[model samples]
Target chain A: MSTPTHEMWTARLRGAWQRNLPIEKLLPDDQPAYVVSWIYVFGVATIAALGVIIASGVVLAFQGPAWYHTSDIGNFTNSMHFWSVQMFFAFMVIHLWGKFWMAAWRGNRVRTWITGAVAFVVSIATAFTGYLVQTNFDSQWISFEAKDGFNSMGVGAWFTVTNLGQMLLLHVAFLPLILGVLTLVHVLMVRRRGVVPPIDAVPGNMEVHK
Target chain B: MTGWLASFLDHPATYLKWGWFQISISNLIVILIMLALFAAAILIKFPKGRE
Candidate 1:
């Protein structure tokens, strides 16, 4: 006899956890030797850049645009935020390119690949909103320039860059929250699936339950 | 440290005086950053053969 829906769902969840996320898999000391490659570094570097971006962003959010643009500490924090965002995109693109060439979607890891792509798109939107909230010549100039693109796409009014409050809200709250959640899900999927096996190792070698 | 590094990325000039338009340091910074990222990506390499 089949169990009730709730009970069956609970059992399935437990089974999934045990099979995919045993303690060792979630926090592993031993990864496959194939992971000993410099290409892998970019993924971790991207995450590190994101940490800096979030930290500096929180500092900027605490102090308003006036303070951030004028005060020394605020300027420093804002620059940190800016440069970290540079690093974030740099590393993310490299990681994305490396994974793409490796065909990272293979080995039953399509969700992992899709989640990463979603996170990338969300992050780009977050960065675009950041540009709009800078409260400088850049913001005004970009707002006007960006207007043409959005107007062409029929989203000019919906995403008006000149709407400072709207831009700020999306930058400091909505976009970051969405990016953060997507990133977390991407990492969780990575942990669940483990890194995809090296292309050479996939042919005849036994697949380790890493 | 991030601030220190960003100092090197300081505005090279105030504005670019063009025939029809003036491009400010902010605009220039975006271009410079993209160039820097492209350069950095080229410099950081993965090994040619599989490990």
Candidate 2:
């Protein structure tokens, strides 16, 4: 059998794209009438926090990891970045917990829930890598401590914290890319399923479980 | 912007002077201001669980 030519591959890919689902089918512009509460903001809040984290991370990148460790300006930017990361994790955990208590996995949303949970797990790993990249006193302590933990768990056989080159690559590239992909998948699943409806339709006193 | 604002807080006429400190100070101030704005938005947007 002959290998597929570039033109054939491109044509097949375009056909797949044409067959792909539309965004509107995934998520409707008009939400259910019962979705009128501030609790929903947790998801958006997490996204916003991530926005800040990315922006701070970008600036810190431009300043370079070495500069961040040594220079005064870079130091402050690094601190801001650290705090942003903390906030990002905080918001994500809250959002995930909130969704769980709300039984957001109901109906056809099990896939969405699973995707979200996987994304959350990846995000935690990303944050852990970020801490390793810090290379501060905290980073040193965490490195040794976490290295031991992972070693005990047999994960250290593959991943090493002391390898600066590997850690840098994972921090600046791999972890982020993994998190980004998982987040994208989670979002697609959520949009496809649409937001889960609140339990009752009463406007004045309808209560949804935590 | 934040760094400049902070430096300007210390020396208001530093713009008349050239310093490598400008970028740092300016970015710091911008970060601070943006943080405050975001905090305010959060408060307003999520007020009493109206999310």
lDDT of each: 0.83, 0.71
Clashing pairs in 1: none
Task: Give per-residue CA lDDT, model 2, range A3-69, as digits (tens).
Answer: 6675588877877654554656564555554455555666777777777877888888787868988
**Deviation in Å, model 1, residue A169 alpha carbon:** 1.3
List fnat per candidate, in order: 0.10, 0.07
lDDT of 2 by residue, B5-48 (tens): 67656753323235654445555665566556445533455323
Model 1 per-residue lDDT tens digits across residues A13-77: 98878887898878876666566567777888999999999988988888878999888898889
TM-score for predicted model 1 compared with the true structure: 0.76
| lDDT for A109 (candidate 1) | 92
